[model samples]
Target: MSPLQQPGAAGPVFALVPVAFPAYLHHDALVDADREVDRIGAALAHLGASIRHWPLEPESRTEANAKARMQSWASREHDLPHSMLAWIGHGAANQDSGWLAAYDTAATIVRRGISVDTVAGPVSDEWLERSGDEGAWSIVLIQACGAGTFAKRLIANLLGKPRDPQRLILIGVGSEGAAYLGAVGDALEEMLEKGFSDNDDSITLADFAYRLRAYLGRRVGADLVVHEFAPDGGTPLRRSPVVPGGVTAPVNVYHELRAFLERQPPDVRGHFVPKAQGAELSELAWYFVGRSRERGRVAGWLKDTACGMLVVTGGAGSGKSALLGNVVVHSNTRLRDLLVDAGFIVALPDAEQPPPEVFDGVIHLAGMTTADLVRRLAEVAGINPAARAAADLDALVKALSERTLTVLLDAMDEAQEPAVIAGSVLRRIAALPAVRVVVGTRPSVHDPQRRNPVTELLDALGAGPTTSVLWVPRDTEATEEYVRLRLNGARKAGRLRATATAVADAAATVAGNGEFLFARLAVHEILARPRILAPKQAKALAELLGKDQRELFAAAVTRLSAVSATFDPLMEALALSRGRGLPRSDGIWATVATALTSGRAVTEGDIDQLLDAAAPYILLDVEDGQSVYRLSHHNFREHFESRLAASA
Candidate 1:
C-alpha cells in the first residue's frame, strides 16, 4: 500500500525522513536527527499530514543489523504518490570520510539510478540527476554544506520537464566558501509543501529570497552567497496557508552577531527560544520558571510606576538578557506598530546606543548610567543642553516627561556608572507626567534607599519572575513542544538525522543541569553542527561527570565562569551547600561555595543567596542552615560533583 494512502492521508501528504548512516554512529547527530523527527511530525500535523515514520536503525548497539534496517528503508517506496522529503542528517561532501558517512549507499543508489522523485540534497548531484531521469516529481533538498550551488543543475533538469520549473527551489546557509545548502534546503521544502507565500502584495519569491539573504546577512553580520539560476522575476511569495494574516516573518530572525558597544535590542518574543534545550523551563529545576503573562504584568507596572526607580534581579544564567530582550523588543514593536497604525510618525528609536542628540521616542539597552540616560533623553526631546544648567537638567527632564514618552532600561546590573546617582536621575524622570519607564536587572543589587530612596517611588512597580518571565524551567509540556518546533525546523532544513526520541533525550540531557542557559547554548552548538556527540567525546564528558544529566549541569555551571569575571566556582559551591549547616569547617563552606558559585552560577553575594535558595536540598546543614551542603537530587549533585573533579 502506498504510505500516502494510509488511514490519515487527508491534508498535505508529507514525509519527513531524516537519514541516519551505517548504524547510528554520531550520537550528537542522532540527537539532532531525533529533533528533526519530532519537529517534522508536529509541522506535518499542523499542516495536516497523515504521517508514517520509519526509523532506519533500532536503539540497540548492533551495527550490522542497523545497516540492514537502513538499506531496507532506502529501498522502500511509498505506496501512494505524495510529497516525499528526507533529511540527510550526517554525511561528508567526500564519500570516503566521516564516521557516519553513507556516501557509498547514497552514491550507489544514484549511480544505479533507482527510481524516486522529490529528492533534496546532502545527496549528491549524481543521485539527483538519476532521480530526475525517472520522470518523478522531483524536489531535492540538501542539508550538506555546499548544496546551494547545485540549484542551477537541478533547475536545468526541471526546465526540460513539462511542469513549471519553479517547483524546484534551492536554499543555503553557512559560508561563501561552500554551496548554499542549508538555506536552499529550508526554502525549497517550505515552498514545495506550502506553495509560494506572502501577504504583502509587494513580496515575491525573489523578494523572499532577497529578504532571506538580507536577513541572514544581517543576522550573521555577513553576506550570503545567493546566486540566481533563472531569476524568473522573483515574485513576492505569499505567506504560508497555515499561518493567517500571511505577513511574512523575517526568515533569519535569530541570526545575531555582536557589533560595537552599542545597546542591544530587547528580545521579548523569545526569538531564541527555538534554539534552547527545551521550550519551557522545568519546575524541578532550581530556578522559578516564568511566562509571557508575567512579563506583561511587570511591564505594565513599569509603565504605571511613573516614578524613577526600577530593578530586576536573579541568579546568574537565570535569563536576564532573554527577558530584557523580550520586554524591550516586544514593547518597541508594539509601540511602533501602534504609532504606524494610528498614522503618527513611525519614528523608530535607534536600537544601537543612543546618540547625545536625543530622538523622538526612547528605547535604551540596559547598562546605561542614569546620567547618560537622562542627558540623552533630554537631548532627543529637544531640550536645549546649552541653556539647561547641570541642575536645570531636572527642569528639562520634567518638561520632556510631560510629553508622550516611554523608557526601557535593560541589564541594570551591568550599568557601568554609579547605581545611586543613576537611580536618583531615574526617579526624577519617572515623576514627570506621560512618562513610562521600564528597568530590568538581576535581583541582587536592589536597594530602595540607594537605588530609589523615595517612598512610593517604585511602589507601582512589580518584579518579573525570572523563571516565567524570562525562562520557564519546569514546563515540560512547553519544553517538549518547543523541542518539537525547533527540531522540526532543523529537520525541514535537512540538518537533522535521528528521530523524535533522540531529540527529546538530547534536550532532556541538556535540561538536566536544569538551567535554560545551558539548554540554549547546547542547541546553538548542535545546530552549528547537527550531529550527536562522538562516543569518545560523550564518554570523555561522562567519565568526567557520570550521567548525561550531571554532564549538562556541570558544563552549564562551568560556562558561567566565562561570562562574568567574578565567578568563584569554589565560593558558589560552598554557598549553595550552606543550608546543610556549616560543613566540618568555615574553610570548607567557603571553599565549596567559592568553587560552585564562582564558576558561573553566582557571582555577587545576593545572587549567591538566590542560587542557594533555589537548591535548598543541596544544603548539607538544613537546621541552622549555617553549614555547607550539596543538592539531594542525585542527578544535580552528581553533575556538579563531576564538574569539581573535571576542573581538578
Candidate 2:
C-alpha cells in the first residue's frame, strides 16, 4: 500500500503540490522561484510526503492556462486527506485586492494575474468544503511579496461564499513587505531540520508557523504571517525518520534529550533553570548546592553493576527531583567524575560493551496510570506505544537487553496508581540486567493507613540501595548555602541594601527549621520587602517565619491574587486540566476565562499578564503540539483545592 493510504499509521501523511511561475511577460522574472520550489519539495519529500511540482511551461504561462491547470489538478487530487498547495512567484496587492501573478501576468489586475476568487472559486470550493468536512486538511503556502494580502482576500473570498474557514490553513508573508529570495524555502528547511534533529515525528501547522516567524525574524529580517482556521492548531505534518525503524543515533539521543529538557518548565528543570539577567548574577544554578553525600551515594550505586535500581525518597520540596534531574541532564559523565572524585575507581566501557542510551523517561507522574507508564516507557525505548501493552513490554525488554540503558523516573508518589507502577512496571523493568533505573518520590503519601508505594517499591527491589532526603535539621548546611548564594545574587542585582552575609544570616534566622521549599519562599519574601530584615522589623520577620508551608503557600496565593482578578479563575482552570495543562492558544484560554469568570470581559492581554504574574507558580511547556500552562507542582493544586473547600 502507498504510505499515504496505509491503514492505521502512526501520524498524518501529506501530499504536496508545488506550483512555480518564474517568468512573466511584463515583469521581472522570479529568478530563484524554481530553485526555491525544488528545495521545499525535497524537504517535504524526505519526510515521506508525496510531491508533485507544477512548473508552468513557457508556451502555457498565461493566466487563463494557469487557472485551467489548477482547476484540473484540484478536480483530480482534492480528495487527498492532507494536502499542501504552494504558489511561488510574484504577488501584487492594492488597497482592497490581491493577486498571485501567473507567468504572463503584468500587474495586480485580475485580468493579468490569478485573483483570490479564481483560486478558491467554482473549481476548488466544493472539494475544499467536502474534504474538510471529512476531516481532511489543506494548507495553502503562498510565497509572494503581498502574500499576507492574498491570505486576507482568500479568507474574505471563502467567507463570502459561505464556506468554513476552518477548512484550510493559510501561510503568507506580510501584506506590504517584500519576500526575499530563498527566505521561505530556507525557513521551511530549517524547521524540518530542527524537528528531525529533535526526533519529533511530526510538526503541526501552528508549530511550523511559530518556527517560521521566529526564523524569518531572526535570519532574514522578514515577517511570516499565518492563519490557522482548522482545529487544534491545524493538522499535523508528519515527518518520516531519516534512519530506518525510527531508531535514534547516539548523538541524536543526546540532542533529543537536551531538547526535551529545554522544553520542560523552569521548576521541573530544577536548579538548572535560568533566571533573567541581573547580569546573569541571579543564576538559579546557585540554588543547587551541597548534595555531595547524596550524589556520591547515587553514583556509587550506579557504579555497582549488580544494583539495577536506586530509590531516593524525601519529603515535599526536599530536592529529590532536583538531584535526579541533574543526573539525567548531565548524563553519566558528570556522575562518573563525581564517583572518581569520591575515590571510586571508574572503569571505561569495554569495546565489546554497548553504548549507553540515556532516557529521561517520565519525570512527572501525577496524572499517570499503569497504562500511561507502559506507553511512556515504550516511547522512551523507541517502540510503538500504540502496540498492545504486552507486545510493547516485550519489545522494550528485548531492546533494553541489547544495550546499556539508564532511565530516570521521578514523582512516583504523585502518580494516580503509584502502587501498580511501583509493584508492576518499575519492578519488572528493574529486573532487566542491562538497565539502570533511578526513581524519586516521597516516603509516604497522605493516606498513612495504606502501604506506601515507596515501601512497595523497596520491598520489590530486595537489596537495591536506597537514599533518603531528610528535613531541615539534617539539611541545614545546604539551606544556608542556598540562602547565602541567593542573597549574594540579590546584592549583585542591587535588590538588597545589606551585605550578602548579613542578609543571609537574617534570612536563615527567619527560615529556622523550614525545608528548602519554605526557605525558597522566605527568601523571595525577604527580597520583595527588604525592610523586613532590619532589626526594628524583627517582630515582622518573626511573624513571617512563624507560618509553616501551608501558610507560606497561602500568602503566595494572596499576593498572586492581588496581581489580577483572573488569578483564581486561571488557577481553577489549570486545576481542572488535572495536570494535562491548558493550551496557550488565545481562543482556548479566552473560552476558559470567559466561562470561569461568568462572562466578565477578558482580553488576551489580561491572560498574558495573568500568566506573567503566575510564572513562579506555573509551568510552561509544549504538550500535544502546542504550548500549555500547567501548575508547577501538585502541592499548588492541593493548596488551591483546600482554599476552595474552606470557602465552601
Candidate 3:
C-alpha cells in the first residue's frame, strides 16, 4: 500500500438521545424546540435512507399494565428490517422505584424487529438481557443524579451478551443512574455523519464509538464514558485511536519529525541531511525537519538534494533553539550530537577544542573572525594550498568542492552585528559551491543591504518571497517537562528542596524565551529565581503583572529614539494632548504610559505636537484628531508612565 493511503476510520459521527421519561419534564421541555429538533433531524437525515419512529408509551402506570405494554411494543418492533432505524421518546420511571415498559412488553418488541435499539435511562439488566437475542443494539444513557454506578452495571451487562460483536454500543455521561440519554444521542448523531459508509453494510462500529467519545471529551470534559462491545471487534479496547502526548515537556521532536517524514516519502539518494548539536540546535532542527516532512506532502524538494540549504529562523523563545538542540542529541553523527546533547551547545575556539582535521565530515564551529572561519574550512577539507603570493578565496572553495560538508553556523549575530560581518567573510562563505551551510537568527537582526550575514547566506541559499522558511514556536508542555527534569535532578543530588509542582509552576511562569531557556546563565536564573523570592511576593508580582499593560510601545519608542531623540518627545506630546498629561504640568505628565514601556520618556514639547507624528502607534480621532492619544497596548503606556518594576 502507498504510505499515504487515507485511513479508513477518518470521518464518522453518531448521536443517541433516548428520553425514556418524557412526561414529568414535558412541561419544562423547550416548547418551541423546532430549531434544535430540525437541526438534529437534518443532520441524521443525511446518515442513511432508513428512518423509523417508535413512541413506546405504557397504557397505564400499573405494574401489570406496564409489563404488557412494553411486551407488545417490543414484539411489534422485533421484525424491523436490517436497514430500519427508529427514534423513541416516552415517559420513563426509575427501574427500581417504578415499572417501565415491562419484560413482556420488551419481549414483544424484540420479536417484531430484527434489531431493536433502545436509548433510555438505565433499565433492568434482566430486561436488557432478554431482548439481547434479537439482534438488538441498546444505547443506554442514565441521566439521573449520581448514576455513575448504575451506568457501569448497564455497560457491563450489555458488553457480555452472546451477540457481542455489532450487537451493542453504549455511551453515557456521569454515573449510569445520573446518565443522560440525550448526550448519547448527540454523540451517535455526530458519529453517523462523519463515519457512515455506504459501501460496507457491516461497519467498524466500535471504532466509531471510541472516536466519538474522544471527540466529545475534547469538546467537553473527559468524565463522559463510552463503551463499545464486540467479541471480535476490529480494534482491541487497550489500543485507543488517539495517542495522548506528554503534556509537560516539549513534544517528542523525534515523533513529530517521523510523522512528517512518513507522510512524505524520502528519496534514498542525494538528500541534504542536517546534523545539529546542543538542546537548542536540536529543537531548531526539529522545526526544519518537521516542516520539510510536512512540505513533502505538497512538494518533494525536501527529500531531494537540489536545494543547497534549509535555513531555520524565527523570534527568540519561539523554539528555534530547542529544535536545533534536539537535532543534535538524536543524531547518529558525533559532531552534531556532541554539541547539542545538553540542549544548547556553544562552540568557539578554545585550547581543548577539536583540531580542524577532526571536523572534515562534520560541521565545524570556529571563532567569529572571517579569516579564522575560512581557514578552518580549508583545514577540515585537508586540501593543501600551493604556496602563492596571496591566499585566494578559490583555494578554500576547491577544498570544499573535493568533499561534501554541511556547515552549521548557529547564532551568527552573537559574534557581532550582521552589517559588519555580512559583506566580506559571510559573502565568501555563501559563494561556496558543492557545500551546504545553515544559519539560525532572529528576523529583527536581519537587514540585507547593510550587513546581515545571515540574510546574505539565506539569499545565497535561494530564499525568496515564494520560498518558505522553517520556524519553531514555543511549546508550553515541553518547557514544563524541561523544568521538571531539571528540578528532579537537583533534588536527587540534595539541592535545597522543593516539590515538583512548585518548581514546574515557577518554570512555566517564566517568559517563553529560547535564549533564557538554553543559556547556562538563563538556566541558573530559572533555578535560582524561585529560591531567591518568597512565594507570596512572587504571587503578588504575578497578580500585578496580570493587570499591567504591555511594554512594547515603550520599547518601540526606545528603538526609534536610538536613531533620534525627538521620537520619544513626539509620542509624549501626543499623550499629553489626549489628556494623559495635563496642559498645566511643566514636564509632560510622565504618566503617559506608552513612552515609558518602550523605555522612552516624553517631554512637554512632545505633548504639544503628539497628534501629527505618532499616528501609526497612537490612535487619532479623525473628527478631532488632537482630542485623544492612546498606546496600542496598555503595558506600553504603563511602562512609560509608571515607575514600578516587574515584581516576579
Candidate 4:
C-alpha cells in the first residue's frame, strides 16, 4: 500500500550513529557520520517524519552491549509499529563476507583494528519475532560501505534459510567515501522529497530502489556503487502502507508560511472575541496553580484600599505573571469582583514583535498600542472611539469620570525603557480621580547594581507608602499542589495516568524540587510519550527534569530544536527582541534576523514552519487579536538571549 493512500499511515525514522572509535580510522569519518545523521534527522522531520538518532554511547561499544541495545530497540513499545533505520558509519567486507561495524566494533587481525564485535549476519534471532508483526514492513538504509553485504547478512540471518518473502527493504552501498556517502545521500533526499511532495509516505520500496540505482548511475557510476537487498531475494522490497506524512499540525491557523506572516495587512477576524484577552485569561486561570500567599495579600490590598498603585517585582518565574493572572482573571470571586468594580482595565500588553523604543511614555505596540488601550476602555465604558481618539487620555478620563478604575499591567519591567512607560504614561493615568495601577515586572539581572525598575518607579510616584512593593513569595506546598493538579488533570483528561500513589509520589517528589513553571513544563514533557506507569520510570523522569529550571528550559528548547531547523533563528530573534516578544509579523522578524546576524540567520523564509517546528518552546498566544511569539517562560528568554549574545 502506498503511504499516501493509507488512512493514517505512520512510521518513525531512526538513525544509528557509530561510536567515536580509536584513532586508526579517520576520526572525522565517524564524526561526519554523526553530523550526517543529525542533518538527515532534521530534514526528515521537515518531511513530517518522526526522526530519532540513537548515538551509541562509549560504554555501549561492546558486542554484548550492542546486541542488547538492538534487542531492546526491536522490542520497544514505540507507538509506530513500522520504522526506517539508517545505519550511518563505516562498512567493510572482512575476508569473504561483508561486515557492518557495531557500536563496540573494532579491528580484528585481518580487519581495521579490534574495536568490538562485528555483525556479519543476524543481529538477534528474536529481533524479527519480537518486532510488532510479520506484516509490518521495515526499511533499513545502511548508509555506509558494504551496505549490500550488511543487508544480505542481516536478511539471511533473519530468514536462517530462504523463508517466505517478509516485508524488509535494505539499501546499502558497495563502497563509500571517508566522508558521508554524498552520492547516495543525494538520492535518499530526492526520494524523500518526492514522497513528501506527493504527500505520500508509501513510496514503494521497489520504486525507491530503482530511483536510488538510477541516481547512483548518474552521479558516480562504479566508483561508489549502491545496492538494495532483501530477504526472499531482492525482487520487490515492499514496506508498510502507513509510512509517511506524520506532521502533527500546521504551524498555525494558516498553513502557508508567507501568507501566515508576510501579508500586507494582518488577518482581520470576522468577529473579535468579546474582551477576548480577558475571557481567554479567565480560562487560563482555571489551571492557576500556587501563589496563594501572593494572591491573598494582593486580594487584601484590593479590598480595603480605595486607591493605590502596587508594583509587583521579581525575577522571571517568581510567579509575578501568575500573581497578576490571579488578580486579573483567576482570583476568587470576591477579590475579582472588587477589582472589577474599580473599573479594572488590564494593560497586560503584548506586541507583535519588539518595536524600537521610539516614542517615550508608551511602549511600542505593534497590533494594539496604548491608544488602542484607551479605545478599548472607551468601549467598555460606553464611550465613543471618536470621542476618545480626539483627546486621548483627556477624553478617556472625562468619559469614565464616574468610574474609579484599577488598571492591572503585567510585564512593565520588560518594556524597553519601561521606567518611562510605567512612570509617565501609567502614572499619569493613575493620577486621574481614582484610577489605580498595579504592574508586574522583572529585575534587570545583568546590571551589576541589580537595580529594580520598580524602585525608580516608586520614587517617581512620590516614594510614598501608597506605592506598595512586594515579592511573590515561593510556596513549596502551593507549587507541589500545582504539579499534582496538572498531572492528575492529565490523568483525568486521559492524556496520562499512573497509580494514584505513583502520581502523588511523583508530584510530591518532583514538585519539592520543581519551580512552579518548571513543574508545569516537566509534566507536559512526561505526558507526550507513552504513559509512565512503571514506578521507577515515573520517578526517574521526574528526577531527571528536577535539576533546575534553566536546565529544564534548555532540555525543552533543545528537544524541539533537534526536530526543526527554524527553532534556532526564531529563538535567537526572540532572545534579542527582549522587552516585547517577537511580533507575529514576518517582515519584522526577517529584518531583525538580518540586523542581528552577519547573514540572515534567524529568518526561515517560511516563519510559520519554523514557528511550528519550534513547538512547546515557542508558544503562540493571541493577545488582543495579535499573534505573539514568546519563549515558554521569561527565564528561558533570558537564558537563550544571553547565549545568543555570547555567540555574537
Which structure among the candidates has the greatest TM-score? 2
- Tens-digit lDDT string for candidate 1 (1-648): 011111222444334444433233332233444445444444334323334555434344233433443343334344322233443333222222122223233432222221122232222232333244232221223333323333333444444554433322344333223322233334434433322221221222343344334334433333234434343443222222211111111112201111100122233122212111111111111112243454555555554454433354444344544454444433444333433454432333334212221113333322244555566566556677663335356676668656865555544443434354344665556556655554544443333225544323223233332111232234444434444555555777787764676666665665554344444445544554455533435554334323343344455455544554443354245334421223322134434444544244222232333333233223221111122233323334445545567888
- In order, the Cα lDDT scores of the candidates are 0.37, 0.59, 0.37, 0.49
* Steric overlap count per candidate: 115, 0, 109, 14
| Per-residue accuracy of model 3 over 1-648 as CA lDDT, tens digit each | 111211233322222232233322221232222233333444443432122322444222223433333444333343421221122222122333211222223422222211222322223332344344454343333333323333455555545655333444554444322224345446545444322211112333454454555445544354465665541333221111111110111222322333333433233101213221222223323223222232232122222332244456655434444454333333334433333453434442232132222112333221134544555456445556541223445667655556666554554443333434444544445445555544454544433224534544345335443334565454555555555555555667665256666565655654343323232223333343445324655664354223211333343465456655666655554433422322112122334433545666443333333322332344221110111223322223344544333532
CA displacement after TM-score superposition, residue 411 of candidate 2 (Å): 0.8
RMSD of model 3 against the true structure: 24.6
Best by lDDT: 2
* Weakest lDDT window of 10 consecutive positions for candidate 4: 352-361
lDDT of 4 by residue, 158-231 (tens): 45544422455555555533223555556545544322221122344454455455555555455343333342
lDDT against true structure, model 2:
0.59
Model 4: lDDT to the true structure: 0.49
| Candidate that beats the other on TM-score, 1 or 4, i.e. the better one | 4
User: For candidate 2, lDDT tens digit of each residue in 123-166?
Assistant: 25534644534555666788877777787777776666654556
The segments of candidate 1 whose C-alpha lies over 4 angstroms from its true place after superposition are: 1-290, 299-311, 327-367, 385-396, 445-484, 533-648
lDDT assessment of candidate 3: 0.37
